[model samples]
Target: MPLYQLNETFWFPPVTESLEDGLLAIGGDLQIPRLLNAYKNGIFPWYEGNTPLWWCPDPRFILFPDELKISKSMRSVFRKNIFDFSINNAFESVIQYCKITKRNGQDGTWITDSMQQAYIQLYREGWAHSAEAWQNEQLVGGLYGVKMGNVFFGESMFSLMSNTSKFAFISLVQQLKEEGIVLIDCQVYTEHLESLGARFISRNAFIELLSTNI
Candidate 1:
């Protein structure tokens, strides 16, 4: 299917219209309403340029709070208590570092200036949140995402030291589970995340899960 071009209209075409590679549409603005609407309907924007590109990939990657895995080594880290984790404590630092930090096999970053600004706006509105890791009062690693009802749509995460991002993520998951969050939208699969119990489900199943959670 040809990619849909979004304009001033706030509505999105159904996620089923996406192309084989999951490039659903292009030419949308990253306004807060559009972002929220997109996520609410299992869509999200991912761009490598000035124009926003929306996507809703098949076989959605996700994690159930109850299924989180703590490997032997990860369990060891938890027992060691080497890092301190906090929520919403250093969101700006976390996001800024994420914007500048390098990732394997990737050039530059997808967390553009506008994207950062947009998420910050969402944070201010209490729709976005961050989980931070600290060592000796210095921020070392963190992650940020949008929270919609009982589901958390993870965006980006960065680590400055080994296992710190995992520490922050584990902490966030445990907290969310305590508060009755049932699903975490991991978006896509990565080996690292898979080890922590994130797996893919069919698009139809994912949509049903989102609807039921909300």
Candidate 2:
């Protein structure tokens, strides 16, 4: 199935249309308008290179603000004020680090140059945001994502020091709670995120929640 097809004009069908057909389509432009529309419709881009690819998996991963877990050691770190946290305060640096940092089980990053530039533009337009962890006035770790209404779609995160990224996540959730945000979309499943209280739900359910909550 073509992931996307130009029907008369450029408007795309609901991403849910592709579930019956696996890995639906490929190749597209990542313009801001298209990205915003895709996100609003519960779709997201996740390609390996210059060619933009959109996806809507059958089972979506997400984390609710109230469900976040604070481990004993993590709590201790916060209690001792190990790092300072801020929001939208150094987004470019955070994304750059995420792009360059090596993953434990992965060889390369999916955050391509085009993706980086797109999100950076989104940040400047206030559609994207970042949470930073600073130690001794130096950025140790952080995460970035797009926030639409009350739904925060987490793109990626990286840690330079133990627990720094976690601290940034906790702070982001805290702020989201204050702002009346309802959902934090993790996009995919990972044990690390599960430990932080992220859970899975049918993609259908996720779309419904976004429809009602966002």
Candidate 3:
């Protein structure tokens, strides 16, 4: 199948049209409405270099709030009060750090200046949110993502202090779950997230979850 190139129409092709590796389209601007629409349909934008690639993979990575795994050590960290947590309190700092935080085997961040600004706009509009960890009122770690209805589309996370990002995430997940959030879209897999009980589900099943949950 040929790849679709997005135009100013501000819509995405059906997720079934995605390529084998989940590349559905390219060239869409990251406007808030487009981003929200993409997320509502289980599609999301990730850039490779400068081109924005939208995807909805066959095996979507996700976490059920009730299935969250907080190991003895993670619990111990909480018991010890290792970090303080808040939501949406340090949105720009969290994302800015996620942009600059170096990861092994990665050169440069995918969160370009434009992408950051785009999400910031979403933040202002109340669709994007951040979960932050603080130490002595200094931002240590956190994550940012798009939240709609009962779904959260996680974008990126970073940690400056030990296990602080995980701390922030676990806290946020528990809070959202208490308030009726059922699904968390991890988007792709990572061992770090796997430890916290994120797993894969079929794209079709994921879409159904979105249909009912959102």
| TM-score per candidate | 0.98, 0.93, 0.98
Q: Residue by residue across 31-132, what tens digits does model 3's lDDT show?
A: 888998899999998889898999999899999999999999999999999789999998999899999999988988999989999999999999999999
Residue lDDT tens for model 2, 1-214: 5456433233667776775522434666678888888888778887755666667787889999999998999999999998999998899999999999999999999999989999999999999999999999999999999999889999999999998888999989989989999999998888878989999888888889889876
RMSD of each: 0.8, 1.9, 0.7
- Model 1 TM-score on a 0 to 1 scale: 0.98
Assess each prediction's global lDDT (C-alpha) against the native.
0.91, 0.86, 0.93
Using TM-score as the yardstick, the better of models 1 and 2 is 1
Residues 24-142, model 1: lDDT tens digits: 99886888999889999999888777878888999899999999998998889889989999999978788899899999989888888999999999998998899999999999999
**TM-score of predicted model 2?**
0.93
Best by lDDT: 3
Decide which is better by lDDT, 2 or 3.
Answer: 3
Model 1, residue 178: distance off in Å is 0.6
